[model samples]
Target: MTGDLGNLRYISPWYGGGMPPDPSLPNRRDARRNRDLFIEHAKATFAEHGVDASLERIAREAGLAIGTLYRHFPTRVDLLLAVFEPKLRDFLATAEAALKMADPWEGFLVFLEALCGAQAYDRGFNDFIARRFPRDERTEVMHDRVCQLARSILSRAQAAGVVRPDIAEADLIALLWANSRIAEATRQVAPGVWRRHMHLVIDGFRAGDRHELPEPSLSPEQLYRVMARLGE
Candidate 1:
């Protein structure tokens, strides 16, 4: 997988030229340095103010013109993909390794820890995982890959009779939504508390001696709409 905008996996129309050149173009030493600065500043800014952070502020902080920022990253999502590319690779790798574990329950726990731990650190990434950007094919691909991995991880656990039979992919997403709120509220007051909260929820997921849930889990359409609205 592509690591960052410097080496973007999928080149969109916004890149000006077709593939091969890479998204961080212009090739000049100063130009490349400017691009790197934008990405570095953006990484910190987005982590602090989230994906909705100000682009103008990022440019100002980087001592670059706003037009320069736009020239390098035409859109907010473009900047985001660049900033979080490495983290995304780590996440995907974690999920893949989880799937390969011999114990399904252990794999499930490992995946959950990686997933929630990611959200607990970066607010932008928290928003990234929680929302759905339907317009961008790149974000769509990222989301689709995540959903596919999640389903495989969950299904593996369920099939092994380690997870509750009633659990669905939607439930895992619901946990993420809940974790996002918990992380936001308690990040400063008590960092790492989300882990405790996750473990509490995870206990309920285990098979055996379970009471019925009060409501049915969301359908695929409903979940999609919920995530899409979050993007809006």
Candidate 2:
């Protein structure tokens, strides 16, 4: 991973070379500080404005030039990877932990709560999870892993007769897209309001009272194309 990221040229003279500094080296303290500041500001900026937040605004917030931001994160996706890596790990961990639970129904609910709760807090992360960056191998891998994990969890619940068998990964993705909009609209006025809507959605997913949908779920290939279009 480091080798792949090293291809990005470090343009800041503060690092004394046109190469990215190793944050672990003692001599690169200032460079590390600047990078940290950029990440900190970028997190807050992205949260407020979504992943498409202005890079110039993030640089301004970090008290650095836009070039400095670019020097550290050569592309918007690179900066997004830095900002979202931890949260992504957390979400994956939550899914893993939920999968380990004895009851599939309980595990499914826990997974949804963790996923939706994370989305409710950060709009940028929400966008990141919703779209597919087909050109970025790293993000593509992450997206594929997340989709597989979600499918596994949903399948487990259905096998246990808790979730409707008709429910698909595409349906879950649609829920995420819907939750993102709900979270954005009521972020200030009522942050916790999403919980009500999420619970209602969950109720609809139950096998006992499932209703026939008007349209068919998107196939895996169709879902991929839709997500890719979202990124574009």
Candidate 3:
């Protein structure tokens, strides 16, 4: 229970969800039975697979037409998002809650860990729109919300004398992106790099802005594309 939402093992209703599925969605009266069938089977199938899981299998299990699946989910990621349902809302909620913690260090820990987990799940955090999907309105909204939460947490942490007073929210977001990338690259050969770097980062932030130097945050997508082209 690291508070990770991606792990379906902890999704309660999903765990108890029966073989047919939950009959809560709005299909026409004529399609109710089959829609419920699809929902139930899709839930189990996606749980077994992931965002890119087999739609054909889901349709087969749901006993619905493949067209029905596409009608319900215009894209795979949308279906993925629906799996977690409140994944974004949960993220925003977590950030907001971190702001109210009593200790600056602990509050910062909560914030850092949340961003870290987001990165761990995908190579991008605050970056859902960069994929094949159209611009995610939720990304912009979540960005602003999380940015405010980060600012509030940092301001409080600085006031408590645990963080550097001059560091801004943009700085934190950039650090999050950088750190997440680091974790992804190193998790295989350099395990625990994420936590180790977090300690190093917080140490720098706590050093009264006197650290020798630090990585300047850049656009991860741009960096990724540039690196991808080097091989071609």
Candidate 4:
């Protein structure tokens, strides 16, 4: 009902905004079973090794042939999309809720906390959020949606004179990149250290008595190039 990927569906009865599964795929029960197995194993492997995890090993662990994996995913992005779909939907919902909060400053904090918390555990998701997949329309659209929501939350706070007016979406993205590295370095040694850093960063975002930043925010094209480089 929604292009070749069926209708857009709820992630569950409680949460919504999940992506549709491909309708072009086989409907046979065995085919569905294999797809489920591949997804389950892939989620774990990606969590451990990021999106570039060995496909061969994932296939072997799923108890399916490599060909079966190729048949379903076709590319690493496809697998990444499948693996992260639910989490992505959850994040979008959180952002939407943040946008609706009465206190713009509180909403800004809520949104940033959700964004950073997502990267604290899964390495694959950490990489996923930081990089840009320019060649894939699906991922591109997903990124666009994220930026849209972020900008809305940011502008709302700026309008309320809570967050600094100079703050941009690119600055928020920079925070995520910083959090990713901090998370990797300190996750084992100090699991909650990233939050401490995030609070400091959040303090810097407050409007009053803030000194001007020395440089302007990154241009959209520059930001795109940076994210593209991360993927490479």
TM-score for all predictions?
Answer: 0.86, 0.87, 0.57, 0.85
- Arrange candidates by TM-score, descending: 2, 1, 4, 3
lDDT of 2 at 6: 46
Lowest lDDT 10-mer window, candidate 3?
A: 124-133
Give me the displacement of residue 214 in model 1, in angstroms. Answer: 1.5
The weakest ten consecutive residues by lDDT in model 2 span 7-16
Q: What is the lDDT of residue 159 in candidate 2?
A: 94
TM-score of 2: 0.87
Residue lDDT tens for model 3, 1-232: 5445435534544554324444754546546666556666755664344344588888877777899878777765556555544555777687778887777789888887777666554532224412223255543454456656777888889888888766766567557657756876786797577788876776778835475546544454554343234212
The segments of candidate 3 whose C-alpha lies over 4 angstroms from its true place after superposition are 1-67, 75-77, 121-136, 189-191, 207-232
Between the candidate structures 2 and 4, which one is better when assessed by TM-score?
Answer: 2
Local accuracy of candidate 2 as per-residue lDDT tens digits, 93-155: 999999889999999999988888898989999989999999999999999889988999999
Model 3 scores a TM of 0.57
Worst 10 residues of 4 by lDDT: 6-15
Q: Rate the local accuracy (lDDT) of all candidates.
A: 0.89, 0.90, 0.62, 0.89
The local distance difference test score of model 3 is 0.62
Better of 2 and 3 by TM-score: 2
**Full candidate order by lDDT, most accurate first:** 2, 4, 1, 3
Off by over 4 Å in 4: 1-27
